[model samples]
Target: MDDGCNQVNPSAALIDLRPVTVLDSITELQTADRHKVAVTGSHGGLASGRHALAHGVAAVIFNDAGVGLNGAGTRSLADLDRWGVPAAVVSHLSARIGDGRDTMRSGVVSACNGTAQALGVRPGHSCLAAVAALRTSAAHAQETDTAGFASASGQVGPHHVVILDSASLIGPDAAGSVAVTGSHGGLPGRRAARALKHPARFAAFNDAGVGKDQAGIARLEVLDSQGVPAVTVRHDSAEIGDGSSTLRSGVVSYANSLAIRSGARAGASLIEVIRRLPE
Candidate 1:
């Protein structure tokens, strides 16, 4: 089977590169029949890949953003494969395009999905090359089955803390408890904000790239404005280890370490940080 989509225009040949703030915006371009591709500033997580697949873009590019735990990279690749869309991810540093919306266009490819690879898209290639490759390859039939690509949800944990690897993991059971996640601080689209609306006492996220533009601190502000008491720890810290490590061991270690360093006992609940906030 050809790994390209009928919607792709080989003659158009031009790579329509545009910067998108969040994964959801990619849907807006779906209505166009032109040979278009999207450069998204978001991480190459499963949610991002799902959006790209759903929108039926010829191709998409994202930042690897360290490809943190719980097989985030693997999940993204799987999504593109199932959807038959070509995709690539660039390093976080190369993600600086122009202003906020334009940043996605500036990165170099660090990784690519199987479809993308078959089209000559590979790591070390410019994102433009990836998109160009997509335009020339056979367009894949659009996928209608989306069951396997559904967003992630939450899981219960000890001490009423909800441990999740993605913001999509936020669920009804998490209400009135603290939520700890390996997901990036950035909540890209309304889906993310809506998922988090459940009445949790607080949330914690890995401060992906710390204060980098469009990432860590930017996302933290988004959560704060929504009236969610959220805190962030470094992505590389023991608190937010790769998802393979048990949350009980990694997340708990991070929380306790944070508390002790802040003049509280190890294992203190994140609610303590909330209490210290100004009324």
Candidate 2:
């Protein structure tokens, strides 16, 4: 059966729709090839994220918004960084922008929804610049095709991070944005960091505070402590989802406000975020 991404067996890749469950079906996906891999499941959170990191798949396509967009999803991005794998997230959320803007986009990486936007860096800029430019980016992607694995959850890579959120999950007042960072190649000179239109610090994190995204920061902090450089996004929505309770518009709005604030606060220490990424 050809699934949306032309999968030979979509069922084989699908994980159970439960909490605290991991996908054993695609465990060997990394060893198979480095092609774009999409992981879909109701409970594809921390456990599944670890598996994806172990496999070191080229890109991760999350089917569910919660799985790869929230706390667990951020951890997955950190894991990918540790493995030196470029990652991309796709979802129905808005992009993260530096100018305190939360815009929305449909298919491609939107300013309000893109990783760079989340970091607050202007488009076509370096990775480090983006993170420094903006305080934080929030939300996860909902659905669509774009560079990397974009989900309503979020996406990260060697030089990029993006977040998207759904109106239902967050709220109407919730803003969307996109963030981008340009590669500085290596050790950026003070002048270079300032002059280069876009200079990105290697995404890394280093902190024990637990930060905002649950276990996600652990990995980034580990790396940031070593000065690997990093960037991150965090968003709070009124209604994350209606796992047991139904999601509502009001709930979503409140949730998004919290998430955006959290992301903004965290954006300041992007390098530290990468250093703290999981090992």
Candidate 3:
């Protein structure tokens, strides 16, 4: 096989480059009809590959397009827009979507804190991470006002790029109040515990199972602890309450993950899943 561009010998035709950081050379080869990229990980160093894509490559492949990706210099989705490249995410967590996901079908936009993750160019994951990598990049950018999300120039300020879970754990020091959407069991329990500590407003969205699970029970505990209130009903049922009064107004929101589980893939999209969140 021939290795794309550099021709050392006939046997060296099959050029296999793994764990490479610089995508300029590879892109040059593919542009010159010397090489082709079949598949790649959505992990760190994806931005380098994006650099190649920006130059007009054939196609790009990604595996873990979820969270914790490190592009070469691209900081967030807005940054990728400047490069004129779209990233495909293969993960579930919300934060991943907030960072690298482009306008592509499988892409997403997520938020995070500057304490955990890092910023890069490509569309995999950022090295920046929060306690659990839950917050989205937009949320992080809003919280810090860092140019990391600046669409003007790549030169941004110094701030943490980590993804945080929810305001339940910490106070409302980050982006606008984040809404939690997931199975109300595992991490929800922990989030509820955190909410009990501070008097912050919140909302929950659970499916049939989650609405009646241990995590749901824990969330109720948090509400009670914080002196908040809640009411749960089947997907079809509706309740009437005053929307104007803060007391009548809810701090926490809940939904059934299984309510409309057909159209969505394994993990539901933020637009679809959390759409019911109070505006």
Candidate 4:
């Protein structure tokens, strides 16, 4: 279904309840004067949850996508808690709700973060119900400033490497550097392609199981088309769900190993691996 966006004013509430097909649509709320609660069709990945939280929403609802490896749902829930905003995830089945707009309006919540639990939102509750609870508990919402938490910086020996937990952290300056990221190798749209095109040295990503759809392979293809050197590491090898696992610690481990095996300099771009010769 085509992604859609809508805003509804719940009765007796001063803020609006927005339903969006993707987490990126949360930007639409930037111009809103009143507080908002977003219901998004996006997976409950660290990047998606962080995007919603950074936008200053009162709460957010996302699809669990089976919670994937490394407990993506659980990590998102923790992230929302740190941001002081209630967050919930509906079943992946709910992702098809009316052009994605209705997913948040009618889907049943499958999990909730700690902040949401404090607001009386529970698993098995309806998305609408969770939003209502958040509205009522808005007064208790903590004042959390996450602007500085979006992207973290680090050094890899002599080269400065940008460490991001998600693909959403990629920016204009990310074009020509060694980047270690926890984002899955799924190039979904033009934005993702553009972001992947910028890494000059090398980019590391999670394989996300390299499922039947072969999304992981597609990401590599797109990067190859753009002439970017990249590699996909097993998500479970490092930490999968939480931001801590997806950061420099995870990326560095894989990058270092790949560099050593490929005879690439420390912090240098990696050479694509060909088939190994039989011993």
Q: Is candidate 2 or candidate 4 better by lDDT?
A: 4
Ten residues in sequence with the least summed lDDT for candidate 3: 147-156
What would the per-residue lDDT of candidate 3 be over residues 101-182, giving only the tens digit for each residue? Answer: 2112232223221212231222233312111122111221111122211011011122211121222233344233332322
- Tens digits of per-residue lDDT for model 2 on 57-131? 433422112222234333444444344333333221321111011111221121222332323333233222222
- What Cα-based lDDT does every candidate model obtain? 0.51, 0.26, 0.26, 0.53
TM-score of 1: 0.59
TM-score of each: 0.59, 0.24, 0.23, 0.57
**Candidate 1 lDDT by residue in tens digits, 1-279:** 232233344554564333222242232335452234666655566655665665556667766655545545335766777666777777655653111243334557778888878767777766655555655544443554343222223434333566665555567777666666655555454234543646565667654554235444344455555656565554444233222222333322133233333332224434344344332
Off by over 4 Å in 1: 1-36, 96-100, 148-175, 187-199, 209-214, 221-227, 233-279
Candidate numbers sorted by TM-score from highest down? 1, 4, 2, 3
lDDT of 4 by residue, 1-279 (tens): 211112222342554434322332232335351246666644567766666665666677765645655675446778778767778887654543111354555577778878778767777777766666666446232344454224566655555557666655667787656666655555543244444645545666665544324533346666655666566655545443333354433422232333334342323222122112011
Listing every candidate in turn, what is its Cα RMSD in Å to the true structure after a full C-alpha superposition?
7.7, 20.4, 17.1, 7.9
Candidate 3 segments whose C-alpha is farther than 4 A from its true place: 1-192, 201-226, 230-279
TM-score of 2: 0.24
In Å, residue 192's CA in model 2 sits off its true spot by 55
Q: Which residue pairs does candidate 1 place in steric collision? A: 4-138, 4-139, 4-140, 5-139, 5-140, 69-243, 70-243, 97-103, 153-169, 154-169
Evaluated at residue 63, the lDDT of candidate 3 is 23
- Comparing 2 and 4 on TM-score, the stronger one: 4
